[model samples]
Target: MSNMHASKLFDVKDKVVLVTGGGRGIGEMIAEGYVSNGAKVYIASRDIKACEATAARLNKQGPGKCYAMAADLSKYEDIVKLIDELSKKEQALNVLVNNSGANWGAPLDEYPDAAFSKVMNLNVNKVFTVTQKALPLLRNAQKKDGVARVINIGSVNGVDPPALETYAYSASKAALHHLSRVLASRLGPEGITVNTLACGPFQSKMMAATLEKFEESIVGGLPLGRIGTPEDVSGVCLFLSSRAGAYTTGATIPVDGGSLVKAKL
Candidate 1:
């Protein structure tokens, strides 16, 4: 009963968090949740303008502050630079959200050779690399009673065959989900936790084209009868980062409104 209250249990106040690809889309939503709840959030992306703009906007709604940085994390050098920059600003990192990703769609017969490598590199390889580079900071945030968090934003496509033919995207996310399990097992003993959220359809730029073309069909097929909202993603994020979720590691919780369950029509 000492910390049973929701405020104390789910509090992320003053936690140093770094969210990559946070300039827009799902990243922006998650960042806003932390900043508004008093977590010192740092958002990064390759687009300097978007990063700067997002930071500026979120800072205005703060009990916590948001910082912006630009880095193309697909490259090893840039990953190193990003971590170095964050290290200079913060001695420790309480949460690291590996949210930036990419996708490519094409018929299997016409898929380009470079699509697999490029998409996989950004969606899977770079996440591992960024987490590796950020280990020291994560370690510093670790403690006997609490742990550092690594939240990888994944897709339900990884959990099931997607409605679209985003082959490489599905493959990469599946790989990411497994990778999170491996990392979680390896790091849990050291006061760190790694988890992935197998998201369903959210209103993201990444999903914009598909939604525009098939909104009705997609909504109709979902068991919950709707797509995801910003609150849906943010609420899950806060839970995972808070004390309430400290015991969860290597989990791939779905944020999809039971879309993977399919409608029983």
Candidate 2:
């Protein structure tokens, strides 16, 4: 009966999780959620210093431990090195959050080709490759209850076209959404679940520039009448990572505070 309780349903204690770009922003929020709830969280970023600093801070508040590993996920060699490093630390991984991404914004006419390429490389290609490489580990971690999970952090801009001109970022997230569905179907038989968290405006360094310009307008437009908070993102992650979300797969769940619906109206 205790196992049927809400707390037990959402329990992720002692789970092994890897969150890329986990040094800050949405990634940091997810890492903090898991760490605070007693999950051994490995947070990685291209910036080693940021990752180490974040790990140090999260470790102090944690029921579980946080570790930092740095890798530039855009390159195949670096991804390989990261997988190797992770393998040395843990034999299995219960969750993988593909949250590392970049955005390039410019007038459509002036948008550089390099910006699109770079954004796509990190946001789309890197996500696919990293998940592919992590399959063995994910498979090993599959619980008898079929609970291994891969959570892709997508954007609401992908579902609803943005008012802003971050062309590549929007496109990449849409692609990631489709990719999550495809992977979910393929991995279902392996007892691994794949899902996308389609998110809206949140307070992250990536959103700082845009929020600085239109925070009020953005909040006003939302039916929820506010920007997303860290708890908003992490609560979704907790559900998707734990038993509560075990039966959900190939789904794109919007953690957007009703922004997508409001945008359509």
Candidate 3:
């Protein structure tokens, strides 16, 4: 193909993308990026006001286009409703971004079982359930490329320990990574791609709260000598969902800026 056509490798024109937890932070950035690239973006979260506000602001910002839908991913009923509602609005579901998650940190000895369950419910169980519920929509929308795209938001902690106490969070992310690989294998013939975006620290609500408890030494520990940003996280998702990443599936692309390679002397 010509270079002009090649530039269209990452094109998402008219595609429909659903981004959970897209009301703010990393999810919001990904939603904006997709909208800029010509996709009809949908922002989903528990906070209806925040979702609507983000949609309005994004609509104000050329080619700005998106909608906001409120649905608690942690709830099965809500997931069904979301899938049903979106199915009615769009003919094909091109992308699904599982970004809604929660975390809690405490010394292992003091970690509460309730906290662990809560985090896992949202971080892991919800991811699996939402994807399962959305699978039909994805299947119905697969192109000749033989599938739709599913992006699971993972964490650097899923690969290595960072002295953090997010026990359930890390484990859940690890499971998500593994699950993505499994889905890729089983769903390949069905024409869908599944991948994980293992991300590094950024200006997220979870990171902001953790930063308050940590120190600058944390950033110093990263090989890149700086923390990651929302762009860093969203860029990988964009690539994976685009034609540029069509051949790639069952891969965990780490957007950690090489933080996982760091070592203590």
How do all models score by TM-score? 0.97, 0.97, 0.94
Task: Write one digit per residue (lDDT tens) for candidate 2, span 1-265.
Answer: 7877988999999999999999999999999999989999999889999999999999999898999998999999999999999999988899999999999999999999999999999999999999999988898899533558999999898898899999999999999999999999999998899999999889999999899999998998789998888899999999999999989999999998898888552
Candidate 1 steric clashes:
0
What does candidate 1's lDDT look like per residue over 58-103, in tens digits? 9999988999999999999999999998999988999999999999
**Candidate 3 structure, TM-score to reference:** 0.94
Q: After superposing candidate 1, which stretches have Cα over 4 Å from the reference?
A: 263-265
Worst 10 residues of 3 by lDDT: 1-10
lDDT of 3 by residue, 2-78 (tens): 63475577777777789999999889888888877777889899998998988988887726478989898888999
Report clash pairs, candidate 1: none
Clashes of each: 0, 0, 2
Better of 1 and 3 by lDDT: 1
Q: Candidate 2: minimum summed lDDT over ten consecutive residues — where?
A: 139-148
The better candidate by TM-score, 1 or 3, is 1
C-alpha lDDT values of all predictions: 0.93, 0.93, 0.84
Ranking by lDDT: 2, 1, 3
lDDT of 1: 0.93
